[model samples]
Structures are given as structure tokens and as C-alpha cells.
Target: MAGPYWFARNIRAGYVGRDRYGKGVMPIAWQGRAVIAGFVAAMIGGGATMFLLFFYAHQMALGVVIYVILVIGGAGTFIWAVATRSDPDKSLAVYLAERQRARSTGR
Candidate 1:
């Protein structure tokens, strides 16, 4: 739902197509791919945590352990993603250039 909206918004915002020079200079595909991948990964992670919590309903201590592990793992991933995130605009520019070159060369 949100993904479609964003894809459309990016396309409308001149982030997915070419300009007067007939050159493709948008990193729309990269952005969309990243967004979808992140969304799916998050959903899976959350679902696994929920399943674990419910599966060990009788064992409260075990449930607590599962929740703790989930929290720690989620926190670690979040921190790593933030710590390693590249400059968005610069990365977009580079992606767009590479895409354009690939298109021109028919690759």
C-alpha cells in the first residue's frame, strides 16, 4: 500500500525518469528496492518474535528470554544500519549514473 504510493510519488517527483537530455538520472528503482526489502525483513523479524512468544506461553521465563533476544537483535540491526548508512543523495547520484551508463551501453 505505502510502497505503491511512494513509487508513484517518486515517479511524480522527477526521481524516476529522464529529463530534456533523454538521460535516466533517477535512483527510483534503488529506492523502491531498498524500501520493499526493508519492509519485508521487518515483517519477518516481527512475526518470528511473535511466534516465539506465543509458542512458549506456558514457560514464562523462556518467553522472557525469547523476547530479550529479539529486542537485542533488533536493536543491534538498527544500530548497524544507522551506523553504516551511506549518504542518500550521493548514493542516489551514483546509482543514477551507473544506471544511465548501463542503459546507454545496452547492458
Candidate 2:
């Protein structure tokens, strides 16, 4: 099926490829990179806000709640994006084997 796919199983040349340990995927494309960047930014922003709220504003409870929400939400979204955007049918081992076969066949 054709799609607005942001990830692929072509590990050697995909934008997002399966991790070597068979646990996750890593960004190899600009789109995937942008997702990572956004996550990092969100985390940093949340941390700064939490720090300010806890120390300066004297709102420790609020700060903790907000920080927890941000962490859960951000992590959930990131995981969802990676899972939904990646090629689901193939694993790292499969891709590696395919690459090996292609190389051997000189194709």
C-alpha cells in the first residue's frame, strides 16, 4: 500500500530503521530527526518550567504534576509515533538478510 510513510524497513537506507538490538527504531531521516528534536525540546521546556514552578513560584505540587504529565504525554506520543510510522512487517534481522542477499546477487 502506498502511504505518507515516514519510516521503512530498508535499514541501510531508510529514514527510520529498526534498532540493532531488535527493541526499537532509530532516526535516519530528516522527518524522524525532527520528531526526536521536538521530543527533546518538549522535555527541556518541561524541566525548566518545573524547576521554576517548584523553586521560584513555591508551587512544588503543581510543578510535580505538570512535570509528570509532560513526561507521560511526551513519552507516549513519541512511542506511538515511532511504532506507527515504522515498517511493522519486518525486523532488523530480516532487513539485514535482505541486504546480504541483494549484495550477493549483485542486484
Question: For candidate 1, what is the TM-score?
Answer: 0.39
Name the weakest run of 10 consecutive residues (lDDT summed) in model 2. Answer: 1-10
Write the residue-wise lDDT of candidate 2 on 38-87 in tens digits. 77877887888899998899998888888788777778877777878876
Query: What lDDT score goes with residue 5 in model 2?
Result: 36
Candidate lDDT scores, in order, read 0.47, 0.67
Worst 10 residues of 1 by lDDT: 1-10
Candidate 2: give the clashing pairs. Answer: none
Cα shift from native, residue 52, model 2 (Å): 0.5
